[model samples]
Target: MAANKILIVAEHAGGALNPSTAKCVTCARAIEDGEITVAVFATDGSSVAAQAAALQGVTQVLQIDNAANGHPLAAVLAPQIAALADGFTHVFGPSTTFGKDLMPRVAALIDTPQLSDIMAVESAHCFRRPIYAGNAIITVKVPADLKIVATVRTASFEAVADGGAASVEKRDVQVDLPTHTRFVEISAASSDRPDLQTARTVVSGGRALGSADGFRILYSLAEKLGAAVGASRAAVDAGYVPNDMQVGQTGKIISPELYIAVGISGAIQHLTGIKDARTIVAINKDAEAPIFEVADIGLVGDLFALVPELEKQLA
Candidate 1:
C-alpha cells in the first residue's frame, strides 16, 4: 500500500495512558517504515496525549478532546476513529478488553475485516495471530485494497521507552452521539500490586487453593516478591478470587518475566495466558501435572507447606 502511515488507538483511563499503547507502537514499528500516530479520545486527554507523544517511535499524537469521550463507548468512539483513519494504511489497538470492544466496531464502520490478537508483523499487509486458544499460530494477509484494522497482542511485544518528541495535534470530529449507550459509574478493583498484564513477576493460584482464604498465601508471596496476583479460571469459578484476577484464555493474557503457578492443574486455557512468560515456576503436588511440561522450574510438593517456607526464606 502506498499509504504507510499507521494510526494507533491509545488506551487510557483516569487521565493516564495505559502502557499497552506503547506496545502497539512497537508492533507498528515492526511494520514497514511509516509515520506512527497515536489517537487519544477523552474529555481532558492532554495528559494522556503527552504520554503517548513520548513513546519512542511515535511520530505524532492526535488528541480528540470532548466531554462525550469521557467514557469510551465503541458506538461513539468508532465513528471518530474511522474518520481519523483517513489516509492511514493501518489502524492499531492493543488486544485488551478496551481494544476488543472498540476495534471491531471501527472495522465494521469502515467496511473492513478486523484482525484480532496479532502477535507478529510479517509485513505491512501480513500478520500472525493465535488460534485454538493459542495452541496454533496463524498467519494472515490483508487485502491490499482494504485498510488494515488490527488489535496487537500486547504481551508479545515490549513497550517502547519514553524518549520521542512527537508533535501533538488536536482533532475535532463531528459525529452523531448514540443515545442508547451512556456512561455509567465504573467500579474497578483497587490494589497496590502491579497490573497483571504489565507486571514483571506474577504469582497465581488455582482451585487447589481451596478457598478465598487460601489465596492469602499467594498474596503474601506476591507481596514479598513485588508481584501481581493472578488466579486460574478454576480459582475464579470456585470463588477464590474476583473475576478480574483471572488469568487464562477467557481472562487476561500476561507475559511476565517470572510466572509462579501454585497449586494449578495447568489447564490448556490457563497455559495460553502465560505462554509468553520468560520463566515459569510450577508448584504442584502432582509431578505429572501438565504445567511441568512448560515450566522452567518444577516443585512437586504441597503448596501449603512450600509457600510459607518460600515466604519465610524471602523474608
Candidate 2:
C-alpha cells in the first residue's frame, strides 16, 4: 500500500489547542506508513499551530489564519478544508461537537462518505465503531479507492504525547465560504471545574440527585478532587443539571482515570458513556444496581451520607 497522507482538523479555543486534536493525531499514526498533517484554522493560529506541531506523530502543520475563521462555524471552514483535501488519503477530526458538526460538511463537500466515531483502527481502510449505545461494535470498511473522512472517538484513543518538532507552514487557501451561516454569540456555562470530556477524574450524579441543588454534593466532592462534574441523561431530563453536563450514549462520552457514579442506577445508555473509564466507583443504596457489574469498587449505601463522608475524608 502507498503511504497514507492524513489530514487532521485541529479543534481550538481561546488560542489554545484542544486535546482532542492530539487524539486524532494518534488515530492517524495507527495507519501503516502514514504521514500526518494538522490544519489549524483561526484568526491567529500560530500558537495553536505550534502546539499541533509538537504532537508525536505529526509530520507538518498548516496554519490558516483568516478573520472568517475567527469562530468555528462549520459552514465557513468546511469549504476551506475541502479545498485543501486534494491529495490527502484521509481526513480525520475528533468525534466532538466541533468535529461532528464540521467533518460531515467536509465529507459532503469533498464528495466522500464519512465514517463516524471510529473507536478502533483495524487496517488502513477498515475501522471499528460502536453501535446501539455501545452495546455492539461494528466494523466498517471504506473502499480503498475512496478518500476516507472520519471522526475519531477521542475517548477510545490516548492523546499523542508531545515530543516532535514538525514544521509549520502558513497557507492562504482561497475558497468561497458560505454566507448563510453567520457567527452568533456563543453562550456557555462558566465554571472553574475541569472540562468533563478531558478531566482525569469525574463525579457524576443521576436522577437520584433529585433536584438541581442536589448536585452541589457532587460539586463539593469534585472540587476537592479537582474533578469535573457530570450527570446521567435522567438527571438532565429532570432539570437537575444542564444538558451539557449529561454523560451517556446521547451525551458526552468520557474516559477518565477515575469515575464516581453517585445515586445513579446505571442505565445502559449511561454506562455506554463511561465504559472507557479506567476506574469506576459506584455509590448507591441498592446493591442490585447494574453499575456494580462494571464498577471496580462498589459502595452499597446512601450516597447522601457516603458522599459527604467521602468528601470530608478527602480534605
Candidate 3:
C-alpha cells in the first residue's frame, strides 16, 4: 500500500485558534507519517493561517479566504476543501460540532466516505473510534484510492511542538453561495477567561456542590491551576451555571491534561466527556461514587471543605 500526503482541514474562530485544530494537526502528523497541508476556510483567514504555520508538522498552509464563508455550513467550504484534497491521501478535522456537521457534507459533496471522531488512525485506511457512548471501540478501513475524511478526537492526540515556519499559500477557490443563510449577529460569551471545552485544564463542579455559591471555590482552584471552570450536566440543568459550561455525553467532551471533578457523582453520561483526561481527580461526599472508579485520586469528603483546602495548599 503506497502512502499519500495528509491534508488537515483546520477549524478556528474569528481571531483565536481553536486548540483542537492544533491537536488535529498533531493527529494528522502521527497518523499519515507524511507531509501536511493545512486548509483554513474563513471570512478572514490570516490569524488561523499564521497559527497553522507555527506548528511543526505543517509543510504548507492554505488560506481559503472567501469573504462569503462566515457560517459553519459545508456547502460554503466543501467544494474548496474537497478540491484541495485532490493531491492529499486523507483530509482531517477536529471532532467538534463544527467538524461533525461539516465532514459528512464535505464527503458527500465529493462523493467520498467520512469517518467521525476517530480515537486513533491505524493507517490512511484503518482508524479506531468509540461507539455506544464510548463503551465500545471500533476499527474501520477505507480503500486508499477513495478520498477519506476523518474527525480527530481532540483529546486523543497531543499538539506537535510549535517551531519552524510554514508556507502560507493562498488558494483561489470559489463555490456557489447558499443564496440563503446570511451572516447575522452572533451573541458570544462575555467571560474573559478561556472557554471550558477548549481549555487545557478544566475544574468541573457537580451536584455535591449544593448550590452555585457552594462551587465558587472552584474558581479559586482554577485560577491557581490556570484552568477553565466547568460544570456537570446536572449542575447546568439546575441552572447553577450556564449551559455552555456543561460537560457530559450531551454536552461538550473535553480532553484536558488535568481534569478536576469536584462534587460530581461521576454519572456515565458525565464520565463519557471526561474519561479521556490524562489525570482525573474526583472529590465527592459519597465514598462509593462511580467517578472514583476512573479517578486517579478520589476524596470522600465535602467539596466545600475539600476545595478550599486544595486551593490553599496549591496556592
Candidate 4:
C-alpha cells in the first residue's frame, strides 16, 4: 500500500527524446499512487532529460551525462542503471529495440525478474501481455517483495502530453562499464520517410513483391501517401527488403492510423504487429487471404496492377 517509487529509463538518440519514453511514462502512471522518475543516460542528457521532465505525472528526472555514454550500448548502460535502482520498487523501459536489448541486462545485473511487453497494469505487481504471437493474452504477476523490472508495450499506450514541469537533477553514477563490447560503426539504412514505429500511416509489402526492385512501386505509393514504408518478415527473409523494415511478431510493433498491406498473405506473425493499427487496407489476388478478415478494406486483385491504379487514385 506504500507509494510506488518507479524509475523509468528514458530512451533517446541524436540528443532528442524518443516518443517511446513518453509512452513508458504513461504506463508508469497507471500504477496507483506512483511517484515516477525518468533516468536519461546520454553523453549530454540535458535536452532529453528536459523533455522527460515535461511529461505529465513525471515527478523527477535524473540526468546522467558521461562521455562513455556517447553511444547507447547495453553493456555500458545496464551497470549504471542497476546502480541507480537501490531504492526504487520498479524499473521500466520501453519495449523497444533499445529497451529489449538493455532491460534484460539490467535485470541480470540487479538479480530481479523482468516481465516483457506489459500491455496493462492490474496492480503494482500484476500486468497483462500477449503470448503465442499475440494469438492469446495472458496476465502475469510478480511477487510484491521483489523489485519489478519490465518493458512497456509502447504501441498499446498513448504518449503523455507535455504539461508538467518536473525538476531535473544531475546524478553521477559510479559503476565500472564493460570494455569487451565496443561501439563499432553502425550501418543503418537511411530514409527520408517517417519512422516506422511512430508514423501515423504505413505501407508494407510482402514476399509477393518478388524482388527488391519490385518494392519500388510500394515506395512510390508510400511517398504519395506521405507514409512510412514497412515489409513483412517473408519479404525480409526473401531479401526483397531489409530486416529493419520488417513489421511482424519478430519485428516492429506499430500502431499507425492507416496501414496499407500489399501482397501480404496475413500470416499470424505479420498480423500481430499491426493489430493495433486503426485502419487496415489489404490488396491481394487471393480472396481467401486471412488479411481480409481484419482489414477495413479489401481488394482482390493483382497488386502489380491494383497498386498502380491505387497510386493513380492517390495522385
Provide the overall lDDT of each model, using Cα atoms, as 2-decimal numbers. Answer: 0.94, 0.95, 0.82, 0.94
| TM-scores of the candidates in the order shown | 0.98, 0.97, 0.92, 0.97
User: Against the correct fold, how does model 4 do in TM-score?
Assistant: 0.97
What 10-residue stretch in candidate 3 is worst by lDDT?
A: 174-183
Candidate 3 per-residue lDDT, tens place, 201-294, comes to: 8999987677888767888788888899989989988878888888887788888888999988888999999988889998888998899999
Report each candidate's C-alpha RMSD, comma-separated, in the order given: 1.1, 1.2, 2.1, 1.3
Off by over 4 Å in 2: none
- Candidate 2 lands at a TM-score of 0.97
Give stretches of model 1 more than 4 Å off.
1-3
Ranking by lDDT: 2, 4, 1, 3
Candidate 1 clashing pairs, residues 3+ apart or interchain: none
- Which ranges of candidate 4 are over 4 A from the true structure? none
Q: Kindly list the per-residue Cα lDDT of model 2 for residues 123-187, writing each as its tens digit.
A: 99999999898999999999899999999999999999999999999999998877899887987
Better of 2 and 3 by lDDT: 2
After superposing all C-alphas onto the true structure, candidate 2 shows an RMSD in angstroms of 1.2
lDDT for residue 303 in candidate 2, whole number 0-100:
88
Model 3: what TM-score? 0.92
Can you list the residue pairs that collide in candidate 3? none
